[model samples]
Target: MTSVPTPDPGPGRQSRPAPHDQRSRPVPRPRPPGPADEPFDLLGIGIGPFNLSLAALADGVPGLAAAFYDQRPDFRWHPGLLIDGATLQVPFLADLVTLADPASHWTFLNYLKHRERLFPFYFAERFHVHRAEYDAYCRWVAESLPSTHFGQQADTVRWNAARGLFEVDHTHLDEHGEAEALDRTYARHLVLGIGTEPYVPEPLRPLADAPAVPVVHSAQYTENRERLLAAEHITVIGSGQSGAEVFLDLLRARPAGYERITWLARTPAFAPMEYSKLGLEHFTPDYTRYFHALPEQVRDRLVPQQWQLHKGIDTETITAIHDELYRRTLDGGWPDAVLTPGVSVRTAGRLGSREVELHLEHAEQGTRSRLVTSAVVLATGYRERPLDRLLAPLGPALRTDAAGRPAVDALHRLELDRSVTGRVYVQNAERHTHGVGAPDLGLAAWRSAVILNDLTALLTGEEHYPLPVRTAFTTFGLGGPPPAATGTATRTAALRHG
Candidate 1:
């Protein structure tokens, strides 16, 4: 890796401003003969935060050649869901490289320092960063990293048995999102960080499809916020953080007594997220290992039972929603809003070109109802983009689980046929195998480090990244020997205890 100068903002000292040219430096675009002639050591499919984390960490490593591709023209993280005052669930330390390599220049602190906001941020003492600021920080890293190539959509990936490498075919899209050219690149290893897509449930799929009633997913909320607010009646579905934020934003925007809004969810209540210190240990690598070791059926059962970990609303958001409703009730009347839980959207259809009717059923009450609304916002969360289309050429080499999902190993590599020598790894696409932590921002850097270390181990027969000794205080299983005992005695003691 090339050596770059590090900026040291000494204790209680702020760094000087970047020069005009340095501040205005444009993102470097890869030239026409992109990685085709000279193959890269690593080639990444999508330039999301997960893969961007890998690129940022890989930058500090020596003799590692890598390139990342994305279909979009630039990096933007959930631009729509970046509601005002919305903060990330995780702290700033969970950036691209801090947890893995704090010394790296790509840290969020460095971004603040470079942008001349270090002192202000220090004074603010904000542990959880605002969503917009986090997006800007990621954009800063994506723009600075020379290895990232935007506007290139990877179409297919195939293993070249003769060359012992993977070939990726891509179409270079113009600013208009039109395909301008086609190209291919070869790499010894491949990493898929294609990320997730907004999911609309089957019952509401048709309404979300039709352009008549202005139905939109929370992923596109910001773009349609004004229209949604102007409607006579608006409904927000799902009980996750996104849904809560969207409902809160709309609630604050509309008049107190005139707010015609309905918030519905399949969950029994607007439950608070599991934010206890020890409860968070489930996101640690140790818990991930234990979860992966369980039987497939057990893993499936535990995921739904742990919904509060990832699916529940943040306490702050829930409080804000209640506070807003309470303040509106001061006028001797409740706000014109309905908040219901344990309700599922059975089906949806257009009442007219300007309105939508939803068939709803309550789980506990065993009752049914219909809601007519001018607009709908579905915040039903995201699903991992399937790799079937892209990996069609290598389909025969892929090993799948009982549910027909790809079997991702502990190192995040897809279980592939023995004949295929090249490795195909995944990011944010292994929740079934690695558990909920697979898509968590806090684990991005750690997973990236693991992938890099595994890659290096394959090449040099030695670990490149230092693995964490231990991450969680809670021991996940009873099969392990007591911490106090040693070696042979520990095994003897375990047998005796048994």
Candidate 2:
């Protein structure tokens, strides 16, 4: 990890204006309150990876009071796809504290050491461990941060006129499955680290309501994997990483002697992520600068082209699936799994007690076809829907990019015109503004640090802890910005409707 100053945009890329001059629309800074101000210094809306990382970082920072609330009762990463053998797309070093505090007791390496697998894991000589291992590591980190954890669903966030702070309304769901309880938290800063929800295509949404058809998103595969595996025929939709991974997982887990599997996707071809070292730099903080500086349309073009890097499976996984299929072919066996790319599901209707009728359009075939399957698995991916519905009245105040993504700065603060004084930080909701690494572990710690810095800067006169350049280099594990400092234009306007 090497650190550099922000760089100038390359050919065809947009250059950034100086920070102060470009967006001089006075950020509605909240006035600092007296001793009777608030209970917690900050309130984190979601306890997913990003905010989880924030909790870990906050633990070490003195006088920084924080509490994280999650809709789930306990800490669980994507439990549905916690496939037995699936591995993290990135290195295990990207765990919670390794990038931020390598020697910290809560690192994945430390978790392995504490579990007495440190030496064994090293001897295994694997770059990435099973996805289960990463989940366990995250659980360990979450458990250690218990004091700051709140198991409740935040229903809405509104600025309390009297308190002069953000009031978060939460529905508490405790262990043993009880009903909701009234719980509230007031803080000077609110961080919306709410995780993403699984997405299924509109044509398939009705299938979700059909019990007989048994439809589910790829993220929840683990829960339905056994049943889907036992089914005579399985149809998987979407060509992204999750879809591919789920299709491969099912194919590999055939019940001794299963016949065939149908994998359908809308893309023309299954594309591999850019594997070049330089290409990977698009995930670094440096890229965030370059991406933030781009014109809206150019940024839109860049996203779809680079979607595979963030949404698709790694090269190793793709190759593994290909190798397995090839082996079966060499053994005089036709591939049981059929990966149909460039096929769109036109519509789906409930069939008999156990099947779904799907009208599909194949681009190359230039024809329409119907497929009946015992089950449908949607790996179509997800959208970062507006926080407005959840924010209620606050939605009117929140700003957006030209594309309607939550407008944000490099610091992950939602761009708002006026409405509220306290800062609203978003963790997983800034992809359009922040780029591919927006929700990754590499940016988790740094983003949290920046949010905290901004919050403190707004509330108190103290500047956020200046991140040591060494930490940025080590934690990011990618090339940094350029060496020379850049300048921002005065009174420049950029579109940020989302």
Candidate 3:
């Protein structure tokens, strides 16, 4: 029942830092008027965690001119999925700037200090913080940062051949998300951290798109939780953590004997996520480097097979679910809940006014059936938001791989034509190139450091953000190590810290 206190709100896009200590002192007022007409060293699109990490790390660097934009009026990470008692998958060390620079002013520890909650957090001994708390911590960082501009939507990007910079057009949005003004900025380098959008399966998209249907994607679960809970019978579809969490939440809300819920998973079983010590190495930089070096075909084949790594319910949540179900069974028979796996929703449609019918196919049993439910929650997960419209102006300069996907190099920079002097880097849009770590919070700080270091070295001869050469105990490939991934200057800086 505890809560973290928020700092005092100041006028527009800025806030007054708490008087926790000298470190909490306001970062100079009026926020530096960043090069209005001149090109910034880097202009990042999307202020999600990945790019937020970049912005935080860049704050500590001396002279890097960078800015981050997002369409949202304020920072909110997966707002709908912030189920009560649901914690982040990764530990707190995976916060905005801790892994890359523990001493950073923007670290979670610093945020805790700023909020005057260090003693509480220390005594609580909680490693993986609640999802809501993580969102609040990020909002704390985003609001305090002068370089991060929310309510700004990047509309188009083009490479200026003569100027050797990237020109970005953005729309300044008001509180209601309407475009208030047109603005433009130029940057020598661009980073896209647009992040992902909730993906409802095609079969269930119709009901979800219907204005009155009691169907929602897990991404918006919290928003529609009340409506869904009031339904006669609710069916939750998905095998990932979101589905598990949503099902668990619904079950807990319903009466003991009349749970009136069905949990359908496409996977063979309600399996636990891979969380073993060594199993987690796949999210380290070592694995990302090894995976990026492999031939494209091999890389493509490996991702789907490794789903349990990045996409499964944690044992804790799974145990909590079982415990709840077990508690219900103690009274008499089982709760009015049906949990089935290896089932796919072939199609779904509204049944007149008060119900929905879903045509389902059981994979292993080779059977088909229909399930009528009053409400549906599709936890089918998310897809990377397409960058086509935003980057269309780049045209031929934006290279692609054999799969027609953007070709991202080992440094996370898009492989573009040699004629274009500017670089376009990606954050979560490079899973095929960077392996599973592309979207992981554990690797967020590290990846940001990598991008910042590379970009800094381009401007100045020195590497600003030092990174360790080896991250994982496992040698990812048959080779001992991928050829030292950093330049000599960068390697030396990392070796000092390694």
Candidate 4:
């Protein structure tokens, strides 16, 4: 397919600076495109931490040609929820390259050293670094890597059978993300790490969509915090880590005696995440291997039961919220905050120009009530970004499971038709098949190592990243051999369509 280049602006009008960052950089473009162009060895769709890990590891390979693209001006991990002093759920070693290759130049410790803060970090002796610092560490790796391209949105992907390659159509955008030109690139292999998006529940969708209503998702908490805090009363919905963080931030910011905030959750009680030593092993590769080899029905039944593994509140965050709320009652009266569990918001609407009315229901009591507040923050969590739109071109070739989701394998490759020889690998999108650890930060580096190992094995008949024989001390199952590298995966892929 031919790509139409952006016409010159005649040298008079300069494009304005892009959003997110003010620093000016060259307008992003892939190398020249035509029949004569050579396909990249690997092309990544998104530049989130998962893909950033892949890019960082790939940079170490002697002559691998790879590029990762994102629509944003630059890498920023959950900018809205980077609440002050909010630490990562996982330890700092769960950084981009540390778990996979600690000696790599892109390790978090190396980033600290480069910034001249290694001694201070050592003195601090911290395990869980702040989320804002984690964001900075990832940004450091992202910005330093030459293979990552910002401001480029991959539009669609279709296989060019004639070339035996995956063809990606992407758009280069101006400052405001207005498309400047359309271009296409070819890849021998494709890796998609386009991360999740903020989710708003059905009951609160209307208020969230209304322009005047102050119903905001926690994903935008930091950005819209001032507007929310200025109101007379605020209600926070959702009981996940995000909900807890938002509620605590608001509680700390509001004045002591008049702190009018309501925190609601559907859980029986505000619970802590599964952080016990044995429970933590669920995020290990051993458990992931066991989870993937389970029967489809069993796998489906297991994910919802494992919510506490990934969706529960941080124990520390929950404790901090309790402490802050308890501290407010020192003068012999409870602070004006209400924390109710086992309740859900049934419906929500704009009560007035600046307020929202939430209809609440208690699950056990079957009781209904209405809470009209000046503002509402939906601390509701995120959902995986659907791949249907991006994979439509290959719909016929792509195989799906009984529930209609993609049939991903233990190696994380889409179970596609044998006609499509090039593998379409996915990251952080296989929770159904792999288990709760699919999106965990601690697993990001391991997953990338697995991918790189397989990718190089297929290309050079040798693995690029050698993985540990085992990662978990606990035995996940009675007996099942863990997934080997691509040697076994190649054979499994061949039999997938048989």
Cα-based TM-score, every candidate? 0.92, 0.83, 0.92, 0.91
C-alpha lDDT score of every prediction, in listed order: 0.83, 0.67, 0.81, 0.81
Model 1 scores a TM of 0.92
Quick one: best lDDT, which candidate? 1
Candidate 2 minimal-lDDT segment of 10 residues:
1-10
The runs of at least 3 residues in candidate 3 whose Cα sits more than 4 Å from the true structure, single-residue gaps closed, are 1-36, 482-498
Question: How many clashing residue pairs appear in each of the predictions shown?
Answer: 0, 13, 0, 0
Off by over 4 Å in 1: 1-21, 32-36, 481-498
Candidates sorted by TM-score, best first: 1, 3, 4, 2
Off by over 4 Å in 2: 1-37, 255-257, 456-481, 484-498
Q: Clash number for model 3? A: 0
Expressed as tens digits, the lDDT of each residue in 347-371 for candidate 3 is 9887887788899999999999999
- Model 4 Cα lDDT, one tens digit per residue, 175-231: 697887778878888888988988987887888655776678888999999999888
1-498, model 1: which lDDT tens digit per residue? 000011111122222223656863645565434443667778888888999999888777666777788888778999999999999999999999998778888899989988889999999999999999999999888887767777788888889998988888888888777888777778888889999999988999889555767899999999999999999999999999999999999999999799999999999998999999999998987788778878899999988899999998889999999999999999798899999999999999888789999999999999999899999999999999999988999999999999999998877889999989888889999999889899999999988888888787677765566656467778889965235433323221222133
Candidate 4 clashing pairs, residues 3+ apart or interchain: none
Instruction: State model 1's lDDT.
Output: 0.83
What is every candidate's alpha-carbon RMSD to the true fold?
A: 6.2, 11.3, 5.2, 6.2
Judged by whole-model lDDT over C-alpha atoms, candidate 3 comes out at 0.81
Q: Give the TM-score of candidate 4.
A: 0.91
What is candidate 2's lDDT per residue for 1-498, written digit by digit as tens? Answer: 000011111122221112434321222212222224355567777777788777676665555666666656567888888876788877787777565556555567867766668899989998777888888777666655533344466676778767777776556565653544655557767777767777777888778767866688888888988788777889989877778788888877774236468988788877776666766766665567567777878877888777667766678778987886776677565776778888999888788888888999999989999998888889888776557666776777777777666678767777765757777778888888777888676666656666665666555655434443322232232455333322321111111111
Q: Lowest lDDT 10-mer window, candidate 1? A: 1-10
